[model samples]
Each structure stands twice: as structure tokens, then as C-alpha cells.
Target: MTAGEDISVRRKKLRYRAWHRGTREMDLVLGPFADAHVESYDHAALDRLEALMSEEDPPLLKWVMGQETPPDNVDLAFLELVIADHHARLAK
Candidate 1:
């Protein structure tokens, strides 16, 4: 992000990107997580998430949904949080 970008502006853009990942499933997997966390995410966690976002959707979605095991580099802890948050949203 540019130095001029406000934190809220940056967070809004990140949320949009998360919701607009190339497929609907990916959008649902990540969009709400970004909405809930981006504003509060520290740079390191946000960087890790951004790196994960660059990964292909199929494998990443599978990892999030627990269909396929993620490689060691994938952040399972964070993915679990996303999954839990998604489930909670669904339960509401």
C-alpha cells in the first residue's frame, strides 16, 4: 500500500480482494474473515495472509475446509480461526 493510504482504506481494499477471489467458494471462505480481522491484523499476520491469498484457490480452499492437508508452510492455526468464524456466521 502507498504511504498515503489510510488503515481503513487499506482494510477495505483487502476485504474487497478477499471477497472477489476468482471463485464463489473462495469468496465465502475468506471474505468474512477479512472483514472481521483486517482492521486488527498486525503486519506480520496480514503479510502471511496476503501470501496465502496468492496461492491457488483450489488447494487453499481445500485446506481451509479440511478436505486436503495443507503443506507445512500453510498456517493451519489461522485457517482454523477463519473456519470457526465462518461456521459461527453460518450458525447465526
Candidate 2:
């Protein structure tokens, strides 16, 4: 499938599962990360994440959920944290 098609399919699946609505601010910070490297596993998500990361330093989860920017290097790490948290929540 084309990139557009792939994005559409993935977006639909994510939305359907309510995956994008992350239960916490940290989850929100990590949602893009998991979406990039884990769940839907799209490289484009990673690219977008990389771009986001490059913009600023790490912010609090609250800030992230509030749409505050994060530093470039921390984006992946941030997402990893969120993904792990998400899994832990699921396991509970």
C-alpha cells in the first residue's frame, strides 16, 4: 500500500482502539513513540518524533500532554516510557 494508505489504515486502527487518547499525560507523551516504534510501528512516526525531539528539551508529562515540545534526543526515550507504562496499566 501507499504511504497515505498505510497512514490511513494505521490511524483508523489506532483511533478505533482508542490508543491515541492515552490515559495519562505520560501516556500521551509516549503514544507517538509507541506508535512510531512499537504498536503501529511506522517509520514515519519515528521521523515525525525525531523532528519533534529536535525542537526542545524534555518537558513534564503534563506539559507534553498540554502540547509542550520536547528535546530531540528524548523523544524516543519519552515514548518508551509511555509504552512501558501503557503495558503496565494493561497488565493491572
Candidate 3:
């Protein structure tokens, strides 16, 4: 989150960004993930989610979809959560 930003504001912004990514496919992936889980996320998790969303759409989408492994610098733990969330969503 940016300097002086309230945590609630940060979460709202993250949700908006997730749902409004330029690509519709990305919107579908990240939007629901943020909606389902962002309320329970702590500051560190929010930081990780923001980091994950910072990645470019194509590479990020590939990673989330398991089409490619994320690099070491990526937030692996959070990515795992998102992947699990995504699959759980699919199962439903």
C-alpha cells in the first residue's frame, strides 16, 4: 500500500485493480480471488497480493493457471493460495 494509505482503502483499491485489469481473462482470475479473500487478508498478505498483481498479465496469468512455474522472486506462498482458490472456484 502507498504511504499513508488506510488498510481498508488499500483493499478496496486492490479489488478494483484486480477486477479491472485490461484483459477480461485476468479480470476473471484475480477479481474473484480478491473478492473472496481480501477481507480476511492481513497486511503482509495484501502486500503479497499487490506484488502478484504487479506482474504483467500474460506471465501472471500463466503462473496462476499453472502453465509455467513462477520464478523465485515471486511470492510463492501467496501464489499457492491463489491457485488453490482458483481451483476451488472451478470445482464449485
Candidate 4:
């Protein structure tokens, strides 16, 4: 969090970033995921979401879409949750 930036503001910014990831595919996947989860996120969860958002669109999209494995440095557990959430949404 930035100096004096409220948690709610941070979450709102995260949601905006998730929905505007410079790729339509990323936007579609992450936007809804953020909508469903971001509000309830604690600081650590928000940081994880921010970290995922920091990646470049191409590789991030591939990872999220299950077309490529994310790097060892990436957060696999969180990524799995994202993938699972996306799949769950698709099944709905």
C-alpha cells in the first residue's frame, strides 16, 4: 500500500488493473475474478494479485489459460486458485 492509501482504494485500483490488463483475454479472465474476490482480500492476497498483474500480458495470459507453465519464481498456489476460479466460472 502506498503512503496513507486506504485498503478500499487499493482494492479498487487492483480491480481496475485486473480489468484493464492491455489484453482482451486477460481482461475477460481477471476482471470477473477480481470482481468475485478482490473485495474480500487481505493485504497479502492483494499483494499477490498485484504481483500477478505486474507480469507482461502474453506470458501471464498463457499461464492463466493453462497453455504454459509459469516460472519457478511465480506463485503456483495462487495461480492455481485463479485457474480454478476461472474454470468454475466457465462451468457456471
Say what the RMSD of model 4 is. 2.3
lDDT measured at residue 35 in model 4 versus the true structure, 0 to 100: 97
lDDT of 2 at 37: 51
Best by lDDT: 3
For model 1, the local distance difference test gives 0.82
lDDT of 2 by residue, 1-92 (tens): 99878776665554333333435544344554445554454666645544443332335453444455444555565555554665565566
Model 3 residue 36 lDDT score: 95
Task: Encode model 1's per-residue lDDT on 1-92: one tens digit a residue.
Answer: 66436665766777899999999999987898898889887677777678778889999888777789989887777777877888898899
> In model 2, what are the clashing residue pairs, if there are any?
53-71, 53-72, 54-72, 56-71, 57-71
Off by over 4 Å in 4: 1-5
Task: List the RMSD of every prediction in angstroms.
Answer: 2.2, 10.6, 2.7, 2.3
Estimate, for each residue in 3-81, the C-alpha lDDT of model 3 and write its tens digit: 5467889889999999999999889889999999888888988999999999999988899888999999998988898
Structure candidate 1, residue pairs in collision: none
Q: What is the TM-score of each candidate against the true structure?
A: 0.82, 0.27, 0.89, 0.91
Off by over 4 Å in 1: 1-9
Q: Of the candidates shown, which would achieve the greatest TM-score relative to the real structure?
A: 4
| lDDT of model 1 at position 9 | 73
Give the poorly placed runs of model 3, Cα more than 4 Å off: 1-5
Global lDDT of each candidate: 0.82, 0.50, 0.90, 0.89
Write the residue-wise lDDT of candidate 4 on 20-59 in tens digits: 8898988988999999999889999989988888889999
